[model samples]
Target: MRAQKQEWYASWFNTPYYHILYGDRDYEEAGAFMNNLTTALSLQADSHIMDLACGRGRHSLFLNKLGFKVTGVDLSENSIDFARKQLEQDASVDSSRITFDVHNMTLPYHDKFDAVFNLFTSFGYFDEEQDNLNTIKSIKKNLKDGAYAVIDFMNVPHVLRHLVISNSKTIQGITFNMNRRFENGFIYKDIEFTDGGNKYHFTERVSALMLSDFQKYFDQAGLELIDIYGDYQLYEYDKFNSSRLIMILRKQ
Candidate 1:
């Protein structure tokens, strides 16, 4: 049988240009968020964490540094390879405490974890709404009984309120032109650029999901929503003002 066609994310996320475009991400901020999150979750010192859609393993590595055993998975093989290479180059980290693999978030991971995290707006990429619910169910299947799961996503209202319709950024001598629009309950971002004598275009489509929408998905997936936060600081969520919609859930 012929192989199934890959999704847009599988192709785009695996590209070197994707890494270049996002290379300036704030790692310190990410680390601080992880610190606050692990503390808030009350994870044990030896807790096992599943970092779903953990591109390049930034959060996974930091979680490992915080004394947790971390399993980071992403659909991008290039990202997983990069994460593994970084792991091999870091001498102070105990390799046994961390692992990186390429896996689909919609499928149940084999090993159960004490806590599962889908961070940095990593959710809501599927064209079909059922896939999003499947991802939630998969997370439930990957968690031990009574364990916690977290999903950090963009606040749709806030994003739409502050949306810049068109913009451009120059990175690594490449100028990327970007345009964004919201239609049919999805946020679409079109990116165009030229590099190495070639022109490229990519589009990112994320469902504009709100708290109520997520509540329905969580309920359908047999998970209970325990808490809601607005940002990396873990403040109470405000529908219009917050930058992030962070949900903390528990398997029912």
Candidate 2:
């Protein structure tokens, strides 16, 4: 039997501690960005949208609230379960307009959505260069002709410029020690924490790909780069100064 390759995200993201560690994430900021983006694009009501890597359906819920039909796909079964439960329990959400599924982003889905979103620096997790490229190709195959796609990623140069080497924070009685480093074209983070008299550790790695790298992938995927933004406000891109590289691409 062939050995199954271990992916960092597969283990780290499945644990409940992952949610606890990142529980303080700025949902308000994320919601603001989504609002700004949908408004900017003038998304029509009832348009079909795919939230690629949609963890627990936070953004997908919001998108559905805005009247778009949303399909939220994540690699983690736990996250997909949580999203499904949320959709079932939430009274305000149009449950029929939202769905959740477990999926791998590197595989192609044909002609299904009017828009696709891979937000919050969700790309570049694969160790193989071709796997990373395959994700873009898969995304291209998922969209209909002339449909828009949004990729919200960190600006590599800006992230390195402002990189904090280490930090410690306590949440819900667990103190998490986090260390960050850049090496061999990848950004790496080591996280350690203790709870209930047990210690746990995990590592995260993502390719430190720049804007030009994404441009090349888009070209190879037969997608056209329509616009680039520096931040959620959608200001023009400034590689050195921007907090994010938000690319708006179109399936050509």
Candidate 1: tens digits of C-alpha lDDT, residues 1-252: 535777888889999999999989999999999999999999999899999999999999999999999999999999999999999898867799999998999999999999999999999998678889999999999999999999999999999999999999999899999999999999999999999899999999999998999999998999999999999999999999999999999976
Clashing pairs in 1: none
For model 2, what is the error of residue 125's alpha carbon versus the real structure, in angstroms, after optimal superposition? Answer: 0.7
Q: Give model 2's TM-score versus the native structure.
A: 0.96
Residue pairs with backbone atoms closer than 3 Å in model 2 (clashes): none
lDDT of 2 by residue, 20-90 (tens): 88877787887888889998878888689999999888899888888889999999888899889987798
lDDT of 2 at 250: 92
Task: Give each model a TM-score.
Answer: 0.97, 0.96
Give the runs in model 1 whose Cα sits over 4 Å from its true position.
1-3
Whole-model lDDT, candidate 1? 0.94
Question: The CA-based lDDT of model 2 is what?
Answer: 0.90
